[model samples]
Target: MSSMSARRGSRIGRGMAWAILIAAVLVTVFPFYWMVRTALTPAGDLFADSHALWPHHPTLINFKRVLGMTSAERARAAGGSGAQINFLWYTLNSIIYSAVIAIAQTFFCAMAGYAFARLRFPFRDALFGILVAALMVPPIFTLLPNFTMVKNLGLMNTFFGLVAPSVLMTPFAVFFLRQFFLSIPKEVEEAAVLDGVGRWGAFWRIIVPMSRGPLITIGLTTTVWAWKDYLWPLLVGRGEHTRVLTVALGVFLQQSPNTQPDWTGLMAGSTLSVLPVLVLLIFLGKRLVQSLNFSGIK
Candidate 1:
């Protein structure tokens, strides 16, 4: 019958959807699996078999070298710089950079979003339109001007330099939070005003609490972006005192000349660098999801 054929077609479509989802997951997760496998594999056994799905002789030697546990003579022989590699310092810098940028951007963006959503002022729409327009501007276009400004301000090689250009809310962040703010009921703010709460008090006690989901979402997103950023930090924080994990990894790659890449150490460093973000998502991912659902983003 026609009904039976339609039911069978629906079942086939559902099966195809599930198949696509599984394939997507595998494609995304395979790289991480390969990185971890290579990190654990012994250097001697890495290229012995090129089609390995798992290490034949797993070892922690790569991790040890990355953590600076190898003897100085061995490190030197491996073509590493004689200077002690301090991965811990690089990690700390990365943490500080991401955290500061996230907090600053979240707070400032919330303030701007609320203003754009609720406050009536001259040229308000025009100003917001400008922000929206800025979203279309490529970040690379601003790099030269930002670099020149930083140099003029003598901020190079400082944490301030790393955070300066992006410390405030981004245009996209402002737009996102503004949309969330617009979804809030104006009656809530009016009620707070009737209770003698000033604008600032109402914003802090009511709007902020109601907007917690969007704020947290923005904070997490900004943190991840800052953590992964390479070019800006590479340009501004060139000194050892200010270098972050990504820069340090790049330096590690170039520490020796005319030698085979330190595939094991590189993989080990990469694995360690990704741990913080992975752990963060593991702990906060549920909260982020709940917030997104509550915010009616879909």
Candidate 2:
């Protein structure tokens, strides 16, 4: 009788867990579903059925309109404002902006982390403590100072201005890599030193190879953050040559002919903007998860 009750309780617990998982997935996926559904929907039909699970008359016309493939008349007819978004150019800009920050930050932060973990410099602990404390300060507080410095250097409306503040490293990133570096055994470095390897050689040849997991993970995360960043880009990347996808979206939002915005075009643009990030996550997701787990263990 006791065994029967325990089995029943286990079943109940399993059912509850599945229910929670399903609910969480639905909550997470519903927004993406709605975005795609709205993008496929004719603007005229948007108000006709506000609670639709899918569009009745799905079309790719919105994509054409957003990509500037459709004629202005055709775009207007399809419920677009006909303001052409330089989608390809903006995408390239976003890629460049994100790539620079991710690659540079990862390399530099790893070095800083190695120094904090292994090197014996004066006031090292105090400096590291200050860095860790920086993680607690809101990023907004630093924005004005960063902007002023960039502007004073005549870097406004340039990619350099957009990426300079974050390209080197962030405190949390250094701290995270430092913790992971601390987990690596000192014997590994000692062996490399006994083989005539210097500090730089040991770091590059031994430590870096072993720390590939964390590096990849941090690189992916930093890329995503830079890609999605809007405010900083909007401020500094306002020129046609430097404008990123997020800023382009803001431009699209304001370019409507009428008071009502181009909902279809906006959604289409959003979908296009998100595709690259989705593909990146899909391919690197396993590594990211493994790295995170490894970092956690460390």
lDDT of each: 0.85, 0.87
TM-score, per-candidate, Cα-based? 0.87, 0.90
lDDT per residue for candidate 2 within 73-105, as digits (tens), equals: 998898877565667788899999999999999
Backbone steric clashes in candidate 1, count? 0
lDDT of 1 by residue, 106-217 (tens): 9998899889999889999999999999999999899989999998999999988889888987998899989988988899898887799877888999999988878898
Best by lDDT: 2
Candidate 2 segments whose C-alpha is farther than 4 A from its true place:
257-259, 291-298
lDDT of 1: 0.85
Give the root-mean-square deviation of each candidate in angstroms.
Answer: 2.9, 2.4
Residue 265: error of model 2 in Å? 1.0
lDDT of 2 at 64: 79
Give the TM-score comparing model 1 with the true structure, all chains together. Answer: 0.87
Candidate 2 Cα lDDT to native: 0.87
